[model samples]
Target: MTLILFTQIFVGLALVFTVAAFGWRLRLFNALARPVDRSTPKGNPRLGILYAFTLGMAPWAKESTRRHGIAYLRGVAFHLGIFLVLGILILSPWLYLLPVTWRTLLALGAALGALLGLAGFIARFAEHNLKALSTPDDYTAVLVVSLFQASAGLWLVYAPALPLFYIVSAIMLVYAPFSKIRHCIYYAYSRLFFGKFVGSRAVLPHSQQGAR
Candidate 1:
């Protein structure tokens, strides 16, 4: 088989493995017992959930983000770039048909994201607390993802790099479910649980703040 064909097959199988792993994880999460709170709620659970997905994600919404605003923003941008790259990957077969301007813009975004990922990797080693908390898996995962983003950006600018990008993408996708990257899949559930707990206690969107 040609190099391109091999890359395509590798990526396809990687995608399938990723989907199956995530599905298993979802089932595992679902099988866990979720205890119901019988207590009366003082606030609106729906509103709290909305806040969890919205305002709660803002840099100023939490102390950690507020303290590390730049880092938080970097993370947000990196994730957005990942999402954009994923979309580009899906349309890669038809990429040549896209306008040059759009391709350039997308490439720029991917480059920026790769830079942010690199920054994160460096920070993990340079920051005292982060360094202390990080495991070898954390370093490997960040390095793989950063390289994937970089390869994607390069592929966007040079068609010859397509195989490299596909290889990196396949590696990242295959590793994600078993690594810290999988936390993304549980982000919504965590936020939902937090929103419900805080809403029931009227701890978030405090009644006093709501009144004002």
Candidate 2:
């Protein structure tokens, strides 16, 4: 088989595995009992959920994000880049059909995201608290993801690098469910739970605090 064909197979299997892993996780999460709130809600849960997915994610919304605004923004950019890369991957077979300007823009975004991922990886070791809290999986996941982003950017710039990008993508996808990256799947659930807890107590929107 040709190199491109092999890479394509690897990526296809990785995608299939990723989907199955997420499905299994979803089932497990669903099996867990969801706690019912018996207390009278002082604030609207719907509003709280809306805020959790929107304004509540702003840097100024939380003390931690506000204090570490740069870090938070970097993370946001990195994730945005990941999503963009995924789109590019899906359209890779016809990438040559895309306009040059669009390809360049996507490449630039992937490069920027790779840089941000590198910064995060370095920060894990440079920041004392982060260094203390980080495990081997954290370091490995960041490194693999950064390399994947870098390869993606290079592939966008030079078609010959497609194999490298595909290989890295396959590795990242296969490792995702077992590593710290799995948190990406659970992030929404965590936010939903937090919104429910805070909303029930009227702690989300300060205006609702008085109603409690």
Candidate 3:
């Protein structure tokens, strides 16, 4: 079997392990007891949840986001690139079938993400506030993710680099659940609780939707 073929196999296995680990973590979180609010309900919890996922995420919705708009947008773009690259990975078998134009677009998108990731890394290392807030895990995660995105960008530009991309992807996926990256998993729960509290209290604009 070709070495490239072997890399694909390894990448597939790594994906499976990463998914399983994430699932296990999710199960544990769900099994834990959730706190119940004793206060009388005044608003619709559903509306709060809607806001959490929607308007609440808007840059203008938060003071911090307003102050750090560029950084926040960079993070949003980086995450979008991450998702796009994962899609690209799944399309690996058929990637060469695409038009050169399409491939170039994909390569450019991933490259932009990699650059943003690197910028974030440098910011954390050089910025006084960010440097004080960062942990070793933050540096490791950003560097690996940056490298992974870089590999993905190159792989799209050159088909022969597929093996390298797969290898890098495998490393990042395997470490994701164990590293601080697992916080992505908690995003849902956080939103849920936010919905519950705001929806219950009739505080904020959720009252427009009426109590659930």
Candidate 4:
């Protein structure tokens, strides 16, 4: 095979496998010593789905470390910024397949939205890292998501051809599902379980009998 083809095959396979392995590791950890929570329920499928949807789409509505006023502003700004960018992502393929006008508007919204997210990322990193409030993985996770979004912005700035942009996006799609970024999808359900549901359930109750 040609060098370019060989490299793509090698890199893509390596990335895919590494991510899959990490996912397996996460599953093992979850099985062996689950994280503590005061929120999950006793396997109610309907409630589980509803909770997941609510948390995934509405994380900002929940309380935060920040108090009311600051939380309101931060949540509004972050979610609005995410919302605008997501709308643009939905529109991007159409822009590619359609006219310049469509492309221009989509590109503009995406560019500005990415910039906003980048700024928030920097602010969050400063707060978490410098303040020593973040775990190493937490900081790394933020950095990866920041890089992913920034890559999208860079793709826009350079106006790389469709193939290259697709390559970057594909890598991101594969990487995100394996990374802390998966929290975006699973966070809501996780919260519902650990937060609202945990306390309400009697199943998996604390052991009153002492271990011998």
How well does each candidate superpose onto the true structure, as a TM-score? 0.95, 0.95, 0.95, 0.51
Q: Which scores higher on lDDT, 3 or 4?
A: 3
Model 2 TM-score is 0.95
What are the lDDT figures for the candidates, one per model? 0.89, 0.89, 0.88, 0.50
Over 1-212, each residue of candidate 3 has an lDDT whose tens digit, in order, gives: 99899999999999899889999999998999977888888777777777878888889888999999999999999989888888988888898989999999999999999999999999997899999999999999988988898998998888789899999999999999979888888988898888668866776454554533
> Model 1 — TM-score against the truth?
0.95
Would you list the rank order by lDDT, best first? Answer: 1, 2, 3, 4
The weakest ten consecutive residues by lDDT in model 1 span 203-212
Clash numbers, per candidate: 0, 0, 0, 7
Query: How many residue pairs in model 2 have overlapping backbones?
Result: 0
Error of 1 at 184 (Å): 1.2
After superposition, candidate 2 runs with Cα above 4 Å error: 208-212
lDDT of 1 at 25: 99
On lDDT, the candidate that comes out on top is 1
Off by over 4 Å in 1: 208-212
State the displacement of the C-alpha of residue 162, model 2, in Å, after optimal TM-score superposition.
Answer: 0.7
